[model samples]
Target: MSAKKNDDRKSVVVVGGGAAGVNIARPLSFKLDATKYALVLINPRPFRVLLPATLRMVVSDADNLGTTALVPYDKIFHAENGTFLQDSVRSIQEKSLTLGSGQEVPYDILILASGLSWTDPIAFPDSAEDTKAYLVRNHEKFAQAGSYLLAGGGAVGCELAGELKDIWPEKEVTIMHKQRLLFNDTYTDRYRRSAANHLTARGVTLHLDDTVEGLPAEAGPATVLTKGGLKLSADLVLKTTGPTHPNTDFIPSFDADALTPAGFVKVKPTLQLLNHPNIFAAGDIIEWNEQKQAIKAGAHAKLVVQNVLGYISGNGSSLKTYKTGFEAILVTNGKRGGISYFGVLWGLIFGGWFTALLKSKSLLVPMFRKESGLV
Candidate 1:
């Protein structure tokens, strides 16, 4: 790690280890020549979260969420060229990052792929041991609760409510969302109607165009009040409607223009920062006007890697452009059934027990393991 040896290579530092960060860093670590490039990935968590499988873990019957989704960094990145550090960035400069430990890492190229933050089970635990405890605690809670209230009509809330009703049919389950329709604006009316019908058929109650104000003070058998004055009682209440903040607060006060009006990093079509060409971004952190799905994030990472390599090779003219296309989502209602919208051209809602077979059975654990080089 001598200064002279390090000076011979270009430092490529990537902040965050979420979907976009890991995907971008793994490829670069494997492809970049060690003598010419230094790849370093920084993340606060010990392990990256597999968000697609988290909802199931929240309501799963399993004692522990076996390593199906959570893949460690050591298994994913190449040792020769990749370096993973568990640290949080405190501040950022034009070409360097100051971590929480007060250590500054200078980089010739920076990639900001730290995705958005989320609540409890949806987000990964800070350590390996904590992840196991979280799964066990949620399993016990789900078993003990007699009634459940899910507040949100988004994919998470709907899917969770569906899972609850399917598992414990005798238990009372209610879902409240501000939107009249399920899912988000990206989905079509046909798909929306299908989800609503399926959930109702599964014996799950729906409260559309309603907002919950707050929960009762009593911990046991609390009554939940809505903004519209509707009241209901449930043993356990889960709020899936919290405000999500981007992890870009580390940016120095001088370079405030890098952030957009909504606080997301503004990136060009090539995924490079709007104001800084040496910096690139992808995933939920970037101000890309599209659904923040894994598919889109993966695509963004591919273009970002290509553009970053071109810039490092002194050939920026070959940068690729990113286009936001039709919205696609494979939403599972529960373990038994689900609905999906593949693309605009497809124009058909795919639902039923077979759709669940594609994901719910194992949450794509084998596929993720193969991608992470665990196999």
Candidate 2:
């Protein structure tokens, strides 16, 4: 089922409708000359899931945050400039994509924003209804559990611990991380310690420099052994160890060398694929030396859009290069407060009042909704 080419216009196809994919496609749809270029965004879901607020959604569904997180793609693009196909890519060819529906969509320029995969609560199902159900189930689990064990102290794990403690303060919540800090080494030691202290102040237990082992498959009552010779018991065990891998299995079929050993795409500073100048890679899939955050992915999208526009307008020499900006992170602990870090002037760390006003209070859901044309 090969899609007919749009007359003489060339297609600029974007894969995955996550943060990077949608950001790239949204700008391209409005900025591109509709007569000369056709924009296509391919994603498996009809709605985009706002991942940052999912931890709070799992613990509590206040203000219907779970439903608000999943924004529909119907208003993202106009028909004259762009087409949104809710389908997954089965394989990638040199000039076209073979979708799961057996349709082949050709492209003159390609952008791969296919993000990585993560465990549930952070990752949701395809449809909006199913995703709501999934959130409800998790919320119920959290409500019923007397003890919660989070098996990774990354952003997700720490934020989740905060959420659980905020909601059920008496319930035992513990985080077992392999690393010595709450977050990775990208942040300052003082900032990391502050995060740990905030959680500890809320009576959340921290098992730093330890790893959980021998956990059952299901999320029920279980006693788990740790690598640090400690036995822990919990009513529910959740693993938020970060991304499993980038969604780049289809890229190997097109150009094997375009991928790195870790399955991330190799790209030039201009955000173009190493082996294919006509293709671009961004977001978590790109092999960039930085923390994989929404801010970083949004920056990648902006750069890719600029570079792609330049390439298509025959001004490739003037294309902009993507430089990793300073490190800025906002880690929320429930709806009341959290921690924030800015890499300016050595480092600037903010506590609950500032964090709450900036993000934790509303989780930036309103901003995302307005951006998605839902407001």
Candidate 3:
């Protein structure tokens, strides 16, 4: 703990401990020379959810899920070698980090792999009418949980409606798709037909090609009033919307303003920020024009770590570019299934049971354990 002892070791600070941060750190922690590199992790959550598997948890499948996903930091990164402080990061310098607790950490290299926060109706109250009355919890607020009005109608929304129908037959589930249906990628008519038929048959209402304009009181408690004067009752307004970076508001050193027009970090081909080669980023935070994937995020982290290692080895930090390729797992739960689009090969396993089991089965406990060095 002495200053002299600390000064003798090189340090690498990583912000965010979710998928990208954990995966990157786990591999590098094992590869780096113990005496040469030190990892300092800053995060707020005690548990990182295995997001793809959360559908099962929504239905209260906590027993098996307890072991499938969720890794405690102590188990994942252990033996008193690395450090984990349960604090959110505020901002980052080239080689330093300012945490919420006012502690400043310096690193030889830095990985800004923080993830994004999902936007719900309440999060942007000004956009909709009476959205406040809908969402209950600040974190898990869903207006449709006990009522009838649904928010989004994409993959998350669609799957959730199906699950609710399966579990609670009498309860009404409404899905508001912004487009016709799962328009992110094209699916064969058979896939849509099977899914639509199954959901409709189960009493789940599919409202496609509609956007929520506002929520009024009369349309209260599961019913939402849209811009087109259409009123629908919904119990829970869940959001399966994608993610964007969090914590960018605090970055001061670089032209943090260069973050994309939509508020994401702009990185070069090598995955380093548009500026500040001393720092790099990955995961949902990076503004890449493509679908977000864990494998790509991991690969970006690897490249960043490699460049960091090169700098340490006195080999000159010339980094290799990070390229994104397609990789997907086909998810089929209930009756219908769609192929997840990976670049070269697409894997298929469909249905709600399989869909939930595909990614959500692991509570991420073991993965965290392995990442944290518990194994």
Candidate 4:
């Protein structure tokens, strides 16, 4: 450690404690010389709410399930514990941050791990207060209503619908995919067929090649008006329509244009921000042509930490990287069990409970929690 930085409390602060952030912070804290390097993690939540398994949580009262787990800041970051700030980030000024409460925290290096945001009523505002309120209330209504019409048959939408079917077979669950279901032309047809066949076999109404023109204006529980004018109503409308990069409004005056056009911090193979060497980022929130999967996000976080340590040690060239062409997609289809869409055989298929055991069965939440220091 440089005597200068050691005296100055050279530290790393990771923003956003979810997915990539936690993964990065854990290892960095693990590697650091406690007396020389300080690690800090900041997020609004007191604990980590394992996402990806959110589907299982919403499907039923399985909050007690292993993957649907959450834990306080103290649980992880065990040794030389990083500072956990439960506040939103208002802006990032170089290696420093301006918290939502107006407090400023400076870091010798920064990791921006804030993940992606969901696209829906609570997130994207399609209308004013009344209209927005109308849309959001539908989520609450649908949760109790049991019957659901999920819009945008993407990963979140499809998984949620499938899990709901698994939990409440009696309820009608329909998915609206604007294109062919999982139009990931990346996978072979065999794998897609197995996964699709499984979901459809569960009475999941796959409404492909359709779009929701709009929702009925009246509040109390409404129907979705399709492009073809077919009216379909359900207990709720869970629109897993899309996801977008988290807000980086702090970028403009701060070398904003230095990032990818998609606003992700552009980094070298080392994952260091190309413009601000001390700043780095990883996760679905990033704008790499990188795949946006939880495992990949965690992998990216590990790379960032390794490179940051290299940067600290003046051995930046030795940082890690994500393996090229790494693709693994696992899904569960309620009654039909599950399937795998992955590499080598490309769209090679797997079957039954074994398929469900892949990532979706809690995204390795139990494993992460164990790794995070809780036995």
The numbered model that scores best in TM-score is 2
Q: Report the Cα lDDT for residue 185, model 4.
A: 55
| C-alpha lDDT values of all predictions | 0.78, 0.87, 0.59, 0.68
Task: Show model 3 residue runs off by greater than 4 Å.
Answer: 1-5, 59-69, 119-147, 186-198, 215-220, 227-229, 316-318, 327-357, 360-375
Task: Measure candidate 2: CA RMSD.
Answer: 1.4
Better of 2 and 3 by TM-score: 2
RMSD to truth, every model: 2.4, 1.4, 5.9, 5.1
The lDDT, on a scale of 0 to 1, for candidate 2 is 0.87
Candidate 1's residue-wise lDDT over 1-375, tens digit each?
222334767889899887788778988978899878888889987777777777777777442445666777886677657788888988887667888877778788999988888764465567889878777787788889999887787888877876787678888888888987987777787888788888888888899988878653322456778888888888887777533688888864537788977779988899988778899999988887798877788888888889988998888889999998778777777666888777667466788766688876666666666655676
Which of 1 and 2 is ahead in lDDT? 2
Candidate 2, which segments miss by more than 4 Å at Cα? 1-3, 78-80
Number of the predicted model whose lDDT against the real structure is largest: 2
Tens-digit lDDT track for model 3 on 290-345?
65655566677778777767666767546677776654434333223222323342
lDDT, candidate 4, 1-375, per-residue tens: 211343556778888877788888888777888777778888866666566555564444454542236555676675656677787778767557788778787788888887767544324222234433543454355457757787776667767767777667888988877876554556666766666677778888877778887743332355878886688888677667656566555655567665666766666666766677788878876666645777788788777877888889987567676564657777655434666766674355677667657665555667767656675
If scored against the real structure, what TM-score would every candidate get?
0.93, 0.97, 0.78, 0.85
Range of the 10 consecutive residues with the lowest summed lDDT in candidate 1? 214-223
